[model samples]
Target: MDVVEFLSQRIAEDEAAARNLLNDRSVSESGKWYERRVLLECEAKKRLIGIVESARQAALAAMVRHPEGDTPWIPEAIEWTTLSLNALALPYVDHPDFERRWLGT
Candidate 1:
């Protein structure tokens, strides 16, 4: 398979993993465990995975409708992805690169 299909399958697998971690009911004291750094990362990954799935669906729909080339939906998806990334990192406001990369402040 080409790179896009490979990447798409990988994303689906990762999304499944993230969702399973988030939805797991077997973990006792979920409140305490969820706050751990790794679990926090898993939460963020779950949120981003939704965005990735949506973008992939949009791209597939666009390709079906107009197979000539990439659709205009891509740029919109990219913008949403950027916003999601920034929101995910909001707690890291004090980072040195935060101002330059995000706010231009």
Candidate 2:
């Protein structure tokens, strides 16, 4: 497809991922800590969704105005999307025993 179409698709994917994170219901509210953690995650996802959507809109607008030239907002969109994806990755990856050691207290 064209550049605009490609970017739009990527934006949609980002939006979808954010929605999924915010709407997550897999973890039941077993305890105070667990409930608090889930709420924090949802809030984070909401903020990420706003950032991604704003960047996507700017990129789309730029593409519309300058269809022949480079879309300047594309970089910002990519950056936000990358940050969002990075946040989804497991933290403390090298230390597989992190949670066990840290949370088992």
Candidate 3:
């Protein structure tokens, strides 16, 4: 799927995983450290989604403003930002919708 869809799925998974961690019986034995870490990861994913969405919006505006493709740098910037975002998806390499290009594999 597209980046937005993929990131959304990942964010949901992270939220679910965090919930499960909180519900686990071993939490008392493990302390709150792990739970906090998981929550942080979920938050980080949310932030990444926001940033990527903004980048996408900027790219769309740039395209609309330069329909003739006169500004080549805009596309290059988009490509670089996309690749950077894709790299963040490496942790989800096994996901069914994960694209191999994300890993350059």
Model 3 alpha-carbon miss at residue 40, Å: 1.3
Clashing pairs in model 2, backbone N/Cα/C closer than 3 A: none
Per-residue lDDT for 1-105 in model 3, tens only? 776678778878887877887888777746557777878887887787788768867987988998998877777768777886787788888888898877865
Residue 60, candidate 2: Cα error in Å is: 0.8
Candidate 1 residue-wise lDDT, 8-100, digit = tens: 344455456655665666655664355354555655566665666677567567768887765777657666655554455455456443443
Question: Could you tell me every candidate's TM-score relative to the true structure?
Answer: 0.38, 0.43, 0.81
Q: Largest TM-score belongs to which candidate?
A: 3
Return the lDDT, model 1, position 104. Answer: 23
Where model 2 places Cα greater than 4 Å from the true spot, the runs are 1-30, 70-105
Better of 2 and 3 by lDDT: 3
Off by over 4 Å in 1: 1-42, 46-70
Residue 34 in model 1: lDDT = 52
lDDT of 2: 0.52
lDDT of 2 by residue, 3-85 (tens): 23333344445556655554676634454445455556656655665666677677777778888867666767766654554
**Clashes per candidate (backbone, < 3 Å):** 0, 0, 0
Pitting candidate 1 against candidate 2, the one with the higher TM-score is: 2
